[model samples]
Target: MKCTAVLAALAAIAITPVNGGPIAYGICQTGCNAVVVACYAAAGFQFGTVIAAAAAPATILACNAALGTCSATCATVALFAPIP
Candidate 1:
């Protein structure tokens, strides 16, 4: 039993890649969401609303790119998973 507990503790330490905690996860998601909202607002589009690439301004495209990068980073660090 004691050996199993020691192994579990070691595993936990081995996996934490950053200052992993609830606060970090919340901050990561909040920041990512803010970027998306700001981008959408700038383009005169709100959340859940989509516009065609050809019709939308360059800001929309840049927003999408930023969102992708943000999501990937958050998942890898905070969630400990890939954006699959």
Candidate 2:
């Protein structure tokens, strides 16, 4: 159990962004609101007003590449992973 806990913590740390690191927001401002919206939409969340509320940050992050905000090598793994 101790080992499992340690591993989990390490995994979390691995995914966390580094200070001064560049994270792509895909053409949106800080926090990548636009990319988050698109990601949510592509994930099939497009519907009513709730869509905006639901897909805000996530969509922005998804579109980070387009925005040229995130680093290609570092953000690649985290960006592709399912929303947390």
Candidate 3:
């Protein structure tokens, strides 16, 4: 299911802070990366352009916010370790 990628991307935006080690860092990196990508994909950027570019501004804006939020999450996780 290709659509399953972003199925819960937005809902998974909020992540709790947890003191973790290597494994946690790996999960954080992978998880946050996936969420951020899914956020953009949900915003219709996956195709390299906006599909309904002007159809729903709110939805696209929400996705944009989600992108920022999820990217912040990635930054937060980066502090967890060297997520490179």
Candidate 4:
């Protein structure tokens, strides 16, 4: 059991940034919102509303590219799994 715990800890460390770096929001998150709004803006929602919905929090897991892999700092492990 102890060995398993140690291995889990090591894996966690391996995915983390050395000093807790900042991450940028994925472009897809923004782009999807833009496209949706552009396609349906006449339905009552304004461009600003779409922009507001697309706006990410001040702090978010920024996507980073590293040696053919994605290395990112995020609030949750699940957040790090997907590239976008």
Please give the distance, in angstroms, between residue 31's alpha carbon in candidate 2 and its true position after superposition. Answer: 7.4
Per-residue lDDT value at 78 in model 3: 40
- Whole-model Cα lDDT of every candidate shown, in order: 0.62, 0.39, 0.50, 0.32
Better TM-score candidate (1, 3): 1
lDDT of 2 by residue, 1-84 (tens): 122233335446655544322232121133334444565577566523443534456654444444344233224433333222
Between candidates 1 and 2, the one scoring higher on lDDT is 1
TM-score of 4: 0.24
Stretches off by above 4 angstroms in model 4 are 1-24, 49-78, 82-84
Candidate number of the best TM-score: 1
- lDDT, candidate 3, 1-84, per-residue tens: 222233235225536534435654355456655765676676566523555656646756666566556555544544443222
What number of clashing residue pairs does each candidate have, in the order they appear?
A: 0, 16, 0, 2
Error (Å) of candidate 3 at residue 78 is 3.1
TM-scores of the models, in the order given: 0.55, 0.22, 0.37, 0.24
Lowest summed lDDT window (length 10), candidate 2: 19-28
1-84: candidate 4 lDDT, tens digit per residue = 122233345446665453321222243233334444443543444434334434533221121121012212222332333221
TM for candidate 1 is 0.55
Put the candidates in TM-score order, highest first.
1, 3, 4, 2
Deviation from native of the Cα of residue 8 in model 1, angstroms: 27
